[model samples]
Target: MVDLELGTLPKGRGPQLSYRLDRAVLGGGRDLKVPGSNTILDVAGLGDGVLATTLTADGSGELLKLNSAGAVVRRTPRIYTLVSASDQAAAAYASDAPLVDGQMTYGATLYSERGGSVQSVELPDVRSIKVMAYANGQVYYSASVKGSEKVAKLYSWRPGSSSRLVKTVPAPLAISPDGKLASSLPATGSDAGCSTVRGVTTGDRLFQSCEQTIGGFTPDGSVAIGTPANTDGNCAISVAALNVRSGAVIRQWRGCFYRVVAEDNDNLLMVALVSGGGQAPFSKSVLVRCAISTGACERATEITAAKEVDFAR
Candidate 1:
């Protein structure tokens, strides 16, 4: 996975910038630059391949995949409005493909790399599809109704089963591996920086945060990586590992993180921001593997112009 390093553009100049995706071994290896369009948004390990979503200079999204050896395998020909995929399996995306009654009509499509097929799914009354998780045998997603942000809903769909509403949550959310629990990210309000975790079937609040932003959960669903709010615009001061059940801090760190990609046992794959000396344009970023037990970090790769990271586990 690649990481995003914050950069500054000249005043009044919009977001006109170029990005790239670079790959290297977790411990140490020569950086292998992935060849593609410059504006790559996310990269994830998909089975024996790597899948990526890129935002073109024309304001369109394109999905591309590379093999384990970093060779381009497949790429979508048309652009999309939204794209979401997993490293374990295929992806689900939406496009403004047609129009009805002089209104733009949208539909969701599932692209399976393993099966080499594309299937469309119905999302009635849903305005936009934010993120999707394919775990167990179901597809978990979040969406909102047209013209209404407060009606955001979490849903699940299984083969031969209709889509079922799990619960109502905020726009961005996270789901467990078994699709049994759903969590909402911090929204804008009084409890703006706190996340809420709830049971998908019962809608019971399992845990809620007060001072930390829940990044995501581990694969086994036992713990979560959270980042505490920093007053000095530096997030390296307070990173916490929280208990999934009690929302209690199990561990903490002082690494400046742009994102927590994934965790395995006691090692954390994180995109860490290197201090740019309080300069105008903060452009240095590195992919680091941290020992959760000791807070020891080893730089694995130097990513140039990284805008976002997508991890496949």
Candidate 2:
């Protein structure tokens, strides 16, 4: 299950975020508070709970591992960003640039809560870097040249290993839950659709879609969930769940802007902006769920007052 965490930004903007846990199911009907956590940057689910990255009053960062009831069971300090957290560990950076930027060489760190150790390693200097996905406890990150998005090099790292270059995936890459496949969308707003790259470890090309902007993958890694894209020249968007191997759409939904988030098993959790998309206090963040076996979506929960919410797998 993609454990969900909601941040209540009463001001409608950031820097002040509260939370509500257990909303994924069972109503998680209560509010939760992390002592001294002012701003939440990112989160990754660990079973029924989550690993959260928050900023302190002095501008430092830390990671808090909370239980199902939202109580901190463990805290790891000096963590500025929560990149990806899996069953055994979490990958993060020690910098404060929101994320890695060309100007920031803040380096990366691997946190093993079970092993009780942290490993830090240096990474290359890039104009902008984005973590496309995590597979086998290794993070596949996309980096660009100092000033150009022309593509620099792809890098992957696992615990106890240094950051190293790997095959460069297409821009805006999306990897399967198991990290066995990848799909790179065409240029922003382009109609060419996507290119499915099978065997991401070997850089082997697979089938391509005429026009499907894959937002992310389901837990089972069998379906590629499409991001919000225009439908039949309309201003609104359509989200489709496409079969990875055959390029067949299992289900599709049309809406203004629905975002696909992570969840447990093979189900999908989505959020839509009932009002025009914007920061909190200005827009409404609504939650919706889609069952893979039935391709049915559930009614939205309490998101009328959402300021900003974060999700991780």
Candidate 3:
């Protein structure tokens, strides 16, 4: 068993913590203190000892980053609309930009290190935009366009160029590493009424299951994980390993599982919520690392609350 620690805070109120798999401890964190509430949407590490977080403040949301010492490295001013019906906005780093907002707005400025530099990018008139991953001098995202009166079409961004039509994926699109494979959720009325995972390379349909959702793809494009939801809708999470090339389910595991995170050459880190009687606070989140080949999971540590958390090579 890895060293484990546990603590608690009030519901929806807690600090967001960052954990480094290398040290197996809470490396750096930030306390989000509001009058009577706390909301942390997402956290990501920049691989260079820097971390980023998206949070709501005074009803408006902003993105901020912290250094290795947990000091406020930079912060972006409130850019979200308070009256907007949906507060969901996807953010990702692009070049020197620490956070780029990928909403429906056109020519929106992207924020770079310390928010001192900003660059504007053109966007098509799409319903929604989502930044899936950023790496290798490129940023991958999905955009939806209105078509056939009320139909929705999906496209992916090609780095500095305009978006490209990957497929007519309905709503949610999950892109794998290197942006080579994209798996899309099915449309409601289509005959293919099942969740489909597709490969972007050969346009191959990988896996389809009514029970599983493709969480993400492994770094090497060798494997992928499918998360299963529970029928009763409590904390039902299961994982299945897939051979990316053959699209076969080679291994499976179950119980309150989250996506795979902080991967290395030999292991993959995953988080699972411990279910008991009461709903556990987010701060008490538990993380475990497993051998990628064996699926041998071991409790790694309890992540503290912070504004952002990420892994490094």
Query: Model-by-model lDDT, in order?
Result: 0.55, 0.55, 0.46
lDDT tens digits, residue span 175-229, model 3: 6655666666666555343456676656677666655566567766677666663
Sort by TM-score, best first. 1, 2, 3
lDDT of 1 by residue, 1-313 (tens): 1222223211121111111233421221112345654565555444545556666676556766666676777777433432233335565544333345656544544333334455556665665565456666666767665666464577666645577766445544677655666677644577765688876677677788867766566666777677764426744445677788999877676656656644455656665566552223655665555555665555545444443432332
- Point out the higher-scoring one by lDDT: 2 or 3: 2
Candidate 2, poorest ten consecutive residues by summed lDDT: 9-18
Superposition error at 181 for model 3 (Å): 1.2
**Model 3 root mean square deviation, Cα atoms:** 8.7
State how far residue 206 of model 1 sits from its true place (Å).
Answer: 1.9
lDDT per residue for candidate 2 within 89-180, as digits (tens), equals: 45444432334443443334433332345565554354345555556777776566445545445667675777666653556467776777
Candidate 1 local distance difference test against the native: 0.55
Q: TM-score for each prediction? A: 0.72, 0.69, 0.66
Deviation from native of the Cα of residue 126 in model 1, angstroms: 2.9
